[model samples]
Target: MKVQRHKCMNERCSYDQQERIPFATGSCSYTHRLARYVIDLLKAMGLKDVSGLMDVSWDTIKDIHVRYLERHYSPPSLEGVDCIGIDEFAVKKGHVYKTIVVDLRTGRILYVGNGKGADSLDGFWKMVRKKGVKIKYVATGCMERTGCK
Candidate 1:
């Protein structure tokens, strides 16, 4: 498929139409229907498997999911959050660790940080305060692992 390129008419402006053509799904080769189909398939299949089945690049599948998530969750709202649980999980056996903060009431992840320490929880604390989510209890990980008293 050949897309006609458009050049800027004004002397000051130098914008050209080299970007991807905006399809019915916004700006992708696959249509909105196909994007949804791919997302549906993703629920049961891995990205690589989906890519193989769809005969598209793995990155394209990932891009489709990412765009969909961004569109749906444009701005995160912390409206009725009261209690949140924070814990550290190992990404790889015991070498790598990360912190995850989940809302106890709604079971939604509020924050995830790289290191498993007080610094990791800093962002969650600041965000909850800014959002005015009046948190009551914060259940953290065990003292045996994180040493929290």
Candidate 2:
């Protein structure tokens, strides 16, 4: 068994690093402290525009997203899951669209795609097929105007 230790930064916080050295005079853990530090740096740098700047590339957002996702997105092994719920929503009206699929039983978000068209759903199906998942049913819905089928 493996254990991960996190040091708290807040002086009054109840939790402490049980296995390693405590953080230097802080109440939150090392991870929380690091996040606060990064946010403060970004704010001090006058980075008001988080979406698309010369210095901040898509890769930067993608990296942060992927890292955070690896911590949260857990897809169950395709063994008995047969029912899936699919839906599409736009980032903004008439702008970028994204599709989402959820496992009906586990209530886990399974897939995400960049478009609301049938092509996006097809791409998800292709990936699942390639992975040899036994898909018994797929229920999908779209916006009233998209007419996705």
Tell me the lDDT of model 2 at 134: 80
- For model 2, the stretches where C-alpha displacement exceeds 4 angstroms are 1-76, 142-149
Q: Write candidate 2's Cα lDDT for 1-149 as tens digits.
A: 23466767888987855454354223322344544444445554533343234344545444444454576566545566688887878787759888887889899777787887666777667767878888777776553423333
User: What global local distance difference test value does model 1 have?
Assistant: 0.79
With a 3 Å backbone cut-off (N, CA, C), the pairs that clash in candidate 1 are none
Q: lDDT of model 2 at residue 25? A: 28
For each candidate, what is the lDDT? Answer: 0.79, 0.61
Candidate 1: tens digits of C-alpha lDDT, residues 1-149: 77677799999998876445555453467777788899999999999999999899999999988998899876556788777788888887889879887888889887887887877667767787788788777788554443334
Best by TM-score: 1
Best by lDDT: 1
State, as a TM-score between 0 and 1, how close model 1 is to the true structure.
0.55
